[model samples]
Target chain A: MVESRRRSGRLASVPTSRNVKVSAGLVALFVVVVAAVAILVGGGDDGSDAPSERASSTTTTATSETSADAATLPPVVTDDPRLLGAPGSSGVTFTEFLDFECEGCRAAYPAVEELRKAYAGRVTFNIRYFPLPGHQNSRPAAIAVEAASQQGKLEEMYRRMFETQAEWGEKRESQAGTFRGFAEDLGLDMKRYDAAVADPATLRRVESDFAAGSALGVQGTPTFFVNERRIDPRSVDDLRNEIDAAIAGS
Target chain B: MTAAPAGTSSDAGVRRLGLVLLLAGILGLAASAELAIEKFRLLEDPLYVPPCTLGGAVDCGSVMTSDQASAFGFPNPFLGLAGFAGVLVAGLAVASGARPGRWFWLVVQAGMAFAVVFVHWLIFQGLYRVGALCPFCIAVWVATIPAFWYVTLHNLQDVAARPSRLGAVARIARENHGIVLTVWLLLVAALLVERFWAPWDSVFA
Candidate 1:
C-alpha cells in the first residue's frame, strides 16, 4: 500500500514552500518560452525569409548575390526546350525550372510572358521541366509537354499546359488523359504523341531536366535563373529589374 | 497541492519523470501552437511561409498542405494543443507530489500510447507521403516520444502488482527505462536519417 510506502519514506516527500515556488517558477518560465516561440516563429513557411518585395525596394544588399557558386548552377544545355528567345540570343540567358502543376509557375506565367514581350531580342528564355514529385499530375503533364515539343508545338503546348493547370493540378490521380486531349487539340500526331507519352525516353527527358535543376539547388518549382544566378524575386518588377540589370551589365 | 491522493507515494524517480513530462509537454505545446498559427496564416494568405521552413530540407508548408496534416478530420496540431495541455497539467500534478491512482495511470497510458502511435504515423507520412518534414511537427514528435516513454515507465512502476509474466518486464521498465527510451528514440532518429539521407547528408557535405 501506498500509505505504508509514504510512511517508510520510499516516496518523494511533499516539496517545501521554496521548492514549490521553484517548480511554479519553472512552469511559468516554460509558459513564457512557449508563448515566445509561438509569437516569434508562428508565420507560415515563407515567414522565415525576408519579404523580398520590401527588401528589394528598400535595401540594395538583399538582392545583390544569389547562389554565387557557379559550380552548383545548371549548365546552359543546348538541346533543352527554348522559348521567348533562342539559346545565346543576345545578352542575358534567362532559364526557369517550372512545374505545370505548380501554382507558383502559373502565376509567374503572365509576368514571364510580359518579360518576353519587353525584352524580346535581348534575352534568351529557356524553360525546363522540374515537375515536383508532390504534384499529382505534374510529371505526366511534363512528359505530355515534351512530347508535344517533338511535334513543333512546344510553345503553344507549354502555354496551354499552364492555362489548363487548374484542371489537373493537385488531383489525387494522374490526368494524363486530359494532357493527351491537349495534345490532340494541338494537332500533335496522335501516334507520335502516344508513343512519346508511353516511352521511357520521354519520361527520362523530363527526369534529366529535374536532375539538372536538382544539381543547381532548385528546391521548388518556378525557380528562375538570370545567367546562372538564382533569382527569387517577389514581383514581376523585381524580375524585370533583375533582367534589365543583367541586360545592362552585359 | 490540495489534490494529492491520500496515502500516495511519489518517489524520486516519479518526480524526475514528472518533471521530464512537464518539460516535454510544454515544448510539444509550443510546437503545436506555432504549427497551428502557421496553418491559419497560410489559410489567410497563400503566399505566407512558415518560420520553421528554412529551406527545402525543412518545409512546413508542403507538409501542412498534405492530406495527412488533417488525418482526424481536423488539423493534427489541434489535437496536440488539447493533448499537451493535459500532459502539462498531469505532469505538474505528479511533480507536486500527487501519486495517481490506477484509473489515472490508465488514462495517462491511453493518452501516451495514442501519442506514440500517432507520432509514428506522422513520421511515415512526413517521410514517404508528404515528402517534406515540418520542423515544428518534428519538434512535437521529439517531445511526444519522451513524454510517452517516461509516462509508460512510471505507470508500470506505479502498478507494482503485475501478473507473474509481466513482473519481469515491469522490473526492467523501472530499472532500465532510460535505456529503453534512448534506444526507442534512436530508432526514430535512424528512420528520419534513412528517409532523408540525401538532403541530410548534403547538409553535412
Candidate 2:
C-alpha cells in the first residue's frame, strides 16, 4: 500500500503543461474574489463609522466629543462605591467607561482585574457604566450591576457580568431572568433585586455614566481614562505598562 | 510543452489547488495576525486605529468589539491562526507530491468543512448582527470556501472509494462545482447588499 502511494506521489513531480481552461477559470475566480474583497473592505461603515443622515444626527446630540481630550476629566461616577484598589486620595487613577454587555469590555475585564490586584492601594481603579445603545441588554445589565453595588457587592456583580457574558451579551433581547439568576446566586434579597432593577433612579444612574463617558469623547466601549488622560492599550501587558508608567511618573 | 498524460492532468489540478491554498493560507495567516495584533493595540489605545479599519462601514473596530468576534469565548483570529497554518502546511505537502490514502483526504474534507461553515456564520453575524465587515475575517472566508470546495471535488473524483449513489453525485458535482460555488458566493454577496442597502446607498448619495 505504501509503495503504491509513493509511486502515485512520484508521478506528480514530472513537468506538465498547465490546463488553459482551469487557468482561465481560476483567473476569473481570482478577479471575482478581488472584487468581493474591495466591496467588503472599502465599503459599508458600521454603526459608529457609517456616514449618513445618522452621523449628522449624532453630531447634533453627541456634544461629548470636545471635552474628552484634556487630562483634567472630572471624577466619573463620583459618590459611587464602584471604586477598587487605592483610596480616592491616590493620585494614579484608572477610570474605565464600560458597557456591561460589550464584548470588548468583557475581554478587558480580566486585565482590569489584574491591574487592580497589582496596583492595590497604589492605584485607584474606578469603573463607570456606559451602556451602549447598540447592545440590547447593556442598560439592564448596567442597572443590575449598579443595583448590586448598592448592596455592597458592586465589584462582585461587575466581575459576574464578564464571567457570565456569553449567556446574555449579544442576544437580541434582555436576559433579565439570567441576571436575576445571577443575583440569586449572589444571595441578594430577591425583593430588593427586583425593585432595584425596576427603579427609574437605577436607570438614571447608568444613563448618567453614559453621559459622562460621551462627554469624555468615548466613542467606543471599554475606553480607559488613566489619571485624566485618555489611554488606549491593546493588551493586558500594554495596560499594565501604561499603568506602570503613570504610577512611576506620579 | 508536450501534452501531458491523461492521469497527469488531475495531478496538475491538485497542484493548482494546492498552490492556491498555499497563497491564500499564507496571506490569510498574515492578515489574521495583523488583525489580532492591531486589536490588542486598539484595546490599549482607542486612538490608534488599524490601517485596515478605514473608518466608516469598513471599521475593524466595530466588528472586533462585537460579541461574535469572540464566538467561542475567545478571539476568532486565534482559530484563523491555527487553521491557516495547517492549510499552509497541507498545501506545501500536496505541492511536493505527497500522495496519501483516503484518510488524509477525509481529514482535509472535515477541516475545510468546519472552516467554511464557521466563516459563513461569521459573515452572517457581521452583516446582520455585528453590522460591520471585518476585513481579515473575510480573507479567511474566501480562502476557506474554495479550499473546502476543491477538497470536496478531489474526494469525489475517486469513484471506488465513494458509495454508489455518492459516486454519481460526485461526478455530477465535479463538473459543476465552479458554477455551484459562484452561485453560492453570489447569494452571500446579494445578502450583504440587501442587508447594508441603506449604508450602501448613502455612499453614492
Calculate DockQ per candidate and list them: 0.06, 0.14
Which parts of model 1 have CA positions greater than 4 angstroms off? A1-8, A11-96, A101-127, A131-139, A146-175, A181-220, A225-229, A233-250, B1-17, B41-51, B54-56, B59-61, B97-102, B128-132, B157-159, B194-198
**CA deviation > 4 Å runs, candidate 2:** A1-82, A171-173, A177-196, A237-250, B1-11, B21-115, B129-133, B154-205
- Residue-level lDDT tens digits of model 2 in A1-250: 2222243553322222123345446657766874675577655543343321111111112335557355665555476636753464457778888777766677667767777777888888888887777667888889999888878778888888889898877687768888888899998988998999999999998888887778777766678877667776544566677878887887
Per-model TM against the reference: 0.60, 0.65
Please give the TM-score that candidate 1 achieves against the real structure: 0.60
lDDT of 2 at B22: 81
lDDT of each: 0.69, 0.68
In candidate 1, what are the lDDT values of residues A1-250, reduced to their tens digit?
A: 2343355464333332333455456556655764575456444323222211101011101111245577666584445555644444566888888888776577567778887888787788888888776566888988998898888888888999989876777689769889999999988899999998999999998988887777776766677889878787644666788888887888
Whole-model alpha-carbon lDDT for candidate 2 = 0.68
Q: Write the per-residue lDDT of candidate 2 for residues B6-33, one digit (tens) a residue.
A: 2222565666557766876897788789
